[model samples]
Target: MVRELLLAHGNGGEETWTIIKDLFLKYLDDPILSKLEDAAVVPLEGHIAVTTDAFTVSPIFFRGGDIGKLAVCGTVNDLAAMGARPMYMTVSFILEEGMSLEDLETVVRSMGDTARSLGVRVVAGDTKVVPKGTADGVFIVSTGIGRVVYPGLSSHNVRDGDIIIVTGTIGDHGACILAAREGLDFETHLESDCAPLWDMVEALLKEGVEIHAMRDPTRGGLSAVLHEWARASGVSFVVDEQSVPVREEVRGLCEFLGLEPYHLACEGRMVLAVAEESAERVLEILRQHPLGTNAAVIGRAQKGKPQVLLRTAYGTHRFLEPPMGELLPRIC
Candidate 1:
């Protein structure tokens, strides 16, 4: 029986199979994964959306979710942003020596639970054990494949007169991690907004919403997404500063820490560009879902020089620049 992960488990020998067959397979069981083949064969139809992501969050476990859950949600959301339906996923893990088997099992179990709930399968995986201190406790890389149901979605598809809507409040995930890492105390508790978003995206498609562009505000947050859309579509954005939704606790933390909430990452939020006429209807649909109850229309796009302009509560306009430098390293 495996008690702890060892280098021999990654040496391409009997121990490796024992751990994979006994532990990983036991948790992530599926016809594709059960084949024990070098590569998984999956069926696909229509255009496919493929995305890969690596997770290196310092504190493996955090409020609302852990590294395992983050790895799955991050990849799933990437495909969701493309208006795709998630189907299959491949996971790889790097484990440090002396890592507890119980902890590894917990992580694997979390991945399995998330995959099942999202109606996706973990069809293939690999594991490696590195010498102690040579690697962090763990790192996960996931690759996802999705079937594109709604086609023609592009960042360049955004046009003048399109309204911008965010699925929920921004900066929740980033602030949650920061507070957890620093042991900061506040009257209100902050939790990461880590979650799978394909269902919410599917709802929009079902309603026949005309989606011009969509992106999950991840590493660079709201500022990054707006700047990217502005540059890609060659249009300017007039954002209402007061209209952008920010949780009271998140706003407080950002103010106390001298951080801009718009620059902080969100794991479960989507920034959308749709026709102005459909903006309110889209927001109405989003609010029906638990994940998007706080959705808001924050801005409108117009034909002008490619840049984002923020109209502040004080009635002043200023350019909203893309975030530069590493705001929070290993924040994904």
Candidate 2:
């Protein structure tokens, strides 16, 4: 019986099979993954959306979710932003020696649970264990394949007069990770917003909303997305700074830390550009979903030089620069 991960488990010998058959299969078993082939065989049709991500969040276990959950959600959200339906995923684990089997199992369970909830199948995977101190406790690399249902979603699709909508309050994940890593204490609670977003995207598609472009505001956060959209679409975004929702706790923490909320990461939130006529319908559909209760239109696209302009409540405007130089390292 395996008590702890060993280097032999990655040597492609009996120990590797034992771990694959006993540990991984026990949790992520499915017809595709059950094949145990060199590569996953998946049938596809229509446009395809493929994405990959690696999760090395410093604290693997955080308030709202763990690295495993982040792994699934990150990949799924990438596809969802492109108007695709997430279908299959392959997850690889890099484990540190002497790591507790219980902790490994806990992470695996969370991965399985998140995948199942999203109707995404684990099609293949790999595992490798390194000597302790050579690596963090664990790191997850996930590759996802999705079928695109709505076509023409692109950063270049944003047009003048388009409205920008954010799915929810920003920076929850970044703040949670920062607070946990720094061991900060506050009366208000902060939790990561790591979650699957396909359901919310699908709702918008079903309503026939005219989605011009979409993205999940992750590492570089809302600032990064807005800057990218402005540059790619060759337009300027005039944002109402006050209309951009920031949770009181998050705002307080950002102020104390001298961090801009727009520059912080959000795992579950999405930034979307849609036709002005479809904006309200899209907002109504988003609010109907539990994940989008806090959705709001924060800005409008305009014909101008490529830049994001933030107008504060005081009628002052400034260029919101693109995030640079690793705001939060190892933040998923």
Candidate 3:
């Protein structure tokens, strides 16, 4: 078998079969996927949530994760934010010619490990190759299908007095990626906070916490999630700047770069709008979990114009703007 990917590997001939059997199937082998059919067949009932995403991070590997892990977590987290239990996935790859098979295997292995940990099955997949320099080393596109475990969680569901909760410190993933790409020399290393959130979110639902809205701040980060909810719910938001969690490393890097930490992305954290009555209990539950140890009530939803008001710790106020354009392109 060729150690470097070639265009013929995607020709749907013997070379393709060799990779499918020896590489992709070797790691992601499941009954459905092993069938090697054009499409996947699985039984899905009840309210199902489906999401698809394409990842093209500049570097395929980074601190705490690689493109493969990002692909799985990104898709799984989308379903989780909707209060769903992720179940099945379809992954496709766009491989650039001359890419190393070893690197490709590393990505596939990461994807398999992540999916297996979450009880998700990769039921279908496809691969295509392009000439070198025409594309990144590898770009992954994934689709996830999940069962809606809890119904009616939406940005529009936030009501007045709903307490906003963050699952963890924000912007770790974004900062980590930025530092890695910039080759910044720092005493403390930054790592991506990229992980699946279904377990934590499921814990909240199981504990009877009433959640109105949940969003994983991705491209535009926590700031984006809050501003979007404010508009969708037709209610203003008041966030205490001090209460919102930000790691020192992340804040330092943002300040050094003249960027706002809140505008950076977080791959694993969740922002929740919960009922005021359940605020403290939610905090108690979140605090007990490993991922939610830093969870805090950043603000509350109120009846006002749709906007996010930032209440500085020094008794000052300002509007937190949503992200514009690409702050850091491909900082996934």
Best by TM-score: 3
Question: Global CA lDDT of candidate 2, please?
Answer: 0.92
lDDT per residue for candidate 1 within 103-165, as digits (tens), equals 888888888889989889999999999999999888999999999999988899899999999
Query: In order, what lDDT does every prediction score?
Result: 0.90, 0.92, 0.92
- Local accuracy of candidate 3 as per-residue lDDT tens digits, 13-114: 998999999999999989999998888999989999999999987678988899999999999999999989999999999999999999999999999999
Give the Cα-based TM-score of candidate 2 against the true structure.
0.97
Badly placed stretches (over 4 Å) of model 2 are 1-3, 185-187
TM value for model 1? 0.96
Candidate 3 structure lDDT: 0.92
Residue-pair clashes per prediction, in order, are 0, 0, 0
Q: List the candidates' TM-scores in order.
A: 0.96, 0.97, 0.98
Question: Once superposed on the true structure, which residue ranges of model 1 sit more than 4 Å away at CA?
Answer: 1-3, 185-188
RMSD of 1: 1.4
Off by over 4 Å in 3: 185-187
RMSD values, in order shown: 1.4, 1.3, 1.1
Across 33-151, the per-residue lDDT of candidate 2 in tens digits comes to: 98988998888888999999999998888889999899999999999999999999999999998787778888898999999988999999989889989988899999999999998
